[model samples]
Target: MTSPLSHLATHEVTNQPPAPGDRDLWAGDIVLRQAIARHGGQPGALEPYARALGTAAMQEAARDANRHPPELHLFDRAGRRLDEVRFHPAWHGFMQLSAEAGYAALPWEEAPGGHVTHAAMVYLASQVEPGHCCPLTMSYAATPALRTTPALAPWLEKLQVRAWDPAIAPMTGKRAITLGMAMTEKQGGSDLRANATTATRDGDAYRLRGHKWFCSAPMSDGFLTLAQAPEGLTCFLVPRWLDHGRNPILIQRLKDKLGNRSNASAEIEYDNTLAYRVGDEGAGVRTILSMVHHTRLDTALAPAGLMRAALSEAHHWASHRSAFQKQLIDQPLMRAVLADLALDWEAALKLGLKVARNFDGTADEHRTFARIAVALAKYHNNKRAPLVIYEAMEALGGMGYVEDTPLPMLYREAPLNGIWEGSGNVICLDILRTLAKEPLAGEMLNAELQSVTGTDRRFDAALKAHRTRWPGLPPEAEARWFAESLALLLQGALLIRHSSDAVADAFVATRLARGSGRIAGAISGCDTGAILARIAPVE
Candidate 1:
């Protein structure tokens, strides 16, 4: 009984992009706004760029960058050794925008709560496109290490520049510059101490001769690499170009990665490459430690932003599409799922920024708390981002699985953050190390939790249990479990203080009191509608 025109009508599509923004992506996020306000930032100032990032043009740039991944040109015409990486224009556009936004060196500028402000901006920008943020993160991280090396004092001006100068040239000629890192070798993955790259003494500098298996942001103007010097493992600043010509950093190849397609990671061989040693020759690990901590914070924050992006997409789709003659969002189970995702997102924001705020504090206690808490936050939040994003994707059914939508991209990006900087086992072991070596960290954590001693009976009981049994640390076999417990306890405490009654109640009931597994939507009947409404973007 159907007419021929019925087929044409059925071809219409529903549920898609063009999500709303507050002239800035930062202001639209209630949790982000709360965190920013608490940290003394005027969200309105970031609105313009945030709105630009959400535009069709910027979103297209993200897709185009990934669609056309960076390609390597190992040789130029006439068989000259070129060793360059060619990227799409969209990649440069993304880089330039972020660079101008001051994501790389805002905290170093000594702004009020600058680290928190930087973290929030990074979180917002990452939701738009994460791959381009890689080099930006490295530049931001490298500032600490660079500050310690007096020999490189003049080059410090280049790092502080806010412009995006992507020209592949000598740092001496460039007005602005970005930094990269090459630490891992074939034999050493996370264990930088085992690096086999050797740096021999040269006149006023050193000559590096070895291979780096993972050289992040190979196109960067400079890199912070590790090599074995006469004393021990050392850190060196290897410029892309030297006085004579381009450094002899032979680009073995660009890694064919699963995700982060917009950015380039390379494997390179250093053939007597010139480099300037930073810090004491044997104190490489100590010198790069601060850099590592900064990157880890961004690593944890990226996934949280990725989760928010996925949730936004899913929520937008649900709000528009109808099934069984009812809007998708109106369904009870979907409500529970979205609400649960929102709860996790809020927890991630609260915890991530809490650690960042500690970075800006001048007190010794704040530094101690950050030392232990950063590891805890990075481990749990990064590990959970993928699962959370996948669940949010599931809320979309078949459409979420398709490549045309952003879900596929978000899904692919989920594991990158957790794997980078440090993987799950590595981060957990770091937490255990902190517990064994740093007593002040534990004391600060305990004191922080005790502030809300009677907020929730469940949280109080869990804290008591943790204090009593935490002295005898768990063995390596159960380090993950121990770390997860610490992270959950910290999140619960932060929520009790920062979050509203509804969010706090839901988090404590599911994460602490019940002690349930990792299933999304496990917490039910706890103002699911309220949380979902707060997080869902208003169009």
Candidate 2:
């Protein structure tokens, strides 16, 4: 499909893959639809949001928001303290769009499968613009944490609104609001106990005097922060604006980071910042755990979305571009590469949504399984996403490295979710800790792994080998090995139960039985046609 005037030009733009401008993220994704339905998540609720995010307008806005990053506005012309970060209009537009679509409010609005649908929305939005997802994810995760603090009833009520009110006003003045987390300090990266920010008790609240090393979405209505109270480290809710005026939040500078440019991350200091304690003193970690748990679900699903977007590009390019008297997609080696990539993408999403379904687990096994399973999903999905994206980029030769396509943006975002919440080692150690401490978690995980044991001998041998490798928990050094093995086994189990035989066989062969090499696709025998059918080529 070319313009009628193409004949008048020096040469026709022949053999070019059409731009993926008008894709329907929900409609085109058969895998996503079936996975959600199979896991009991309502796809009807996701259709509207997915369709809107895939529009060409939203896609361009995503690029613009990242191209022009947020600028820090430190002071007003009158010399009054005005610590604010101004984003491009496109950033605000996406913020409003996702807010209206329930990116943050869906779970709290109380749908039967809200968490599952929310996880699907996370995957959809991350495909278009992941930068905007940070604040919304914090908003969604903070809902459960805020339940412990009854003093913030007004703010909690605002969370129910499925609209974006970007007004820099109090909760009473706004129809909707968002919350941010600022627990990481200068001294303690992941260790909250090392926080030196001190909080002194005030009448009904406390005044915090400390600097937060990273404060994302600095313009957020409020932030959930941690400070050293006399009792111990305590979680506090610090509002950006007080009734009197702006709080003493000093924006030191914004972080110039590798990716997630559309969202702002800044280093700000709390200069006697007025705040309200969230939970019991010394229970900061326990209180924040709820937020961390929910956010981990997003982190697990984001990489799969990134993979899907990147591979879709490669799939379209190879289908049309010709080489050596054959289309690139027709080449055996290319098909193998794409099929392997699709395998990982499919497994990741299935496992992630399955974990989301358990977020509101009524059964004890469901609750405990979700706790340990999310750690595994986040750790393993992120481990493969970067390489999967890089391989997809290489499929286009040199064009993939340029900015004409979204490959570069997807690549930059691939490694982000891995770093957020918990890094690789941190997640691996957490897996070991959860399995050792919670006997039910181990039992639930064992039940999941053993569910499909008899169906596939390859998966069975892999499971047996995993158990025999370390009769008990492996040493700390073997945690990564342990986590990867368990995650793969779990993924294989799910595919056996839900996916087509072709998909299950390929996964068991390459992943569980180690049929592939240390690369994306090196397997000799696989149902490449059936696997490649998971994604459609450009028509």
Candidate 3:
């Protein structure tokens, strides 16, 4: 069968505008049109290239936003490429479909579906492909304390090989070749202060010795690895193949993961391998953190996409499936559920777009909003999606639990959203920390709340009541309390489109009138409706 994305191959060539009826295609098409216009209509110009790359990258990311493979295997058991297998093309087609649909794509053909793919693609394009040199180059850039690091002048020139290569393609729908970021050791995941890998300064080259766990994209061409230099933590570029020498790294094991099975996550060892320092020593953590900030956003987006897909399935199921001699759509309960899902999905989608905009260079206010928005979207979507999946399944009776239904896969994959990037606890803590540092964040939040309350006196009254009832507290305590409260605030901000104060206020009022109890539940994390109500409310 011809895949839905078969049209994309000829989309540019034909010069036919996208149909206005399909919102996904229209969104992408409009963006592309604006980008082309901004670039003076020359598709090959640098600005145009960047814009096209960004647009295509987003589309690619959305293609596999939700769904997981049957197994975790970017490569076969024998450590051979899995893309060579027959199923690769089908999976690729599926990815394109998701992208065209404005859903998320998977890293590997069989990985769990979600918005992470979009974030990953964007991160790869912005940070890895355009920001730094290859993984090897990034490692070399982090040598011996990062102070004496040489300018990347020579390496940066050589990194242009990626532009022509185009790791991701809209027409062919091929996956990009990855350069693994393998930094973690068994002793530590985030606490790089405890990494034990060593890089001894050999005569002409550094000899690396270490074991790395969670080496993502292990089968890629090279790795950006972190090692303990005599000076401090340093990074190195270790290639899979050398022009004149044999491969130096050895694969120890591939992790059997709960999600993202198509992307290789391996345990690896390097023994006396020759390496070049990236930047100065002790800069490894800082450099990697920069890279990871982008990666975390990507990770957060993946689950956002998954939740969207799950909600979509729920919407479809509710509208079509029948029970108790009536269509599920006829039930007030189901309508409420579906409505909440729609609201949540729209909020997440808008939040994801806003984050992308900030990454593309928006104001500091937008940047702050994007951070809070992304975190809240990830938190709420991760929690809400499974319930939608469950309700969808329940509505479908036995069919929902069956493998034949997408609901089962969505249910299994939903939990990973919360775990990947960072757990809910970690993200919430980060949000709290951000609130602590920026008194302005709270003020901005309060402004937002007031704006929302202004639209409906009732909602304003409710918010005032809640605020008054909530005692005055220190910044730290306020941060904790505000985590959930801020989520609600952002939810209102998003629903109002953040485009106008009045719309946001109206959304808050409507939500308050219909779901005060549910809102309270969300803050406490007890009832699923707390999350659901944010998305689909009674009103």
Best by lDDT: 2
Please say which candidate is ahead in lDDT: 1 or 2: 2
lDDT of each: 0.85, 0.90, 0.49
Candidate 1 vs 3: which has more lDDT? 1
- Please provide, for model 3 over 28-50, each residue's C-alpha lDDT reduced to its tens digit, 9 standing for 90 to 100: 23222332233222222223323
- TM-scores of the models, in the given order? 0.96, 0.98, 0.65
Model 3 vs. true fold: TM = 0.65
In Å, residue 142's CA in model 2 sits off its true spot by 0.3
What's the lDDT for candidate 2? 0.90
As a TM-score, model 1 comes out at 0.96
Candidate 2: residue 363 Cα off by (Å) = 2.2
Clashing residue pairs in candidate 1 (N, C-alpha, C atoms within 3 angstroms)? 23-47, 24-47
Instruction: Order the numbered candidates by lDDT, best leading.
Output: 2, 1, 3
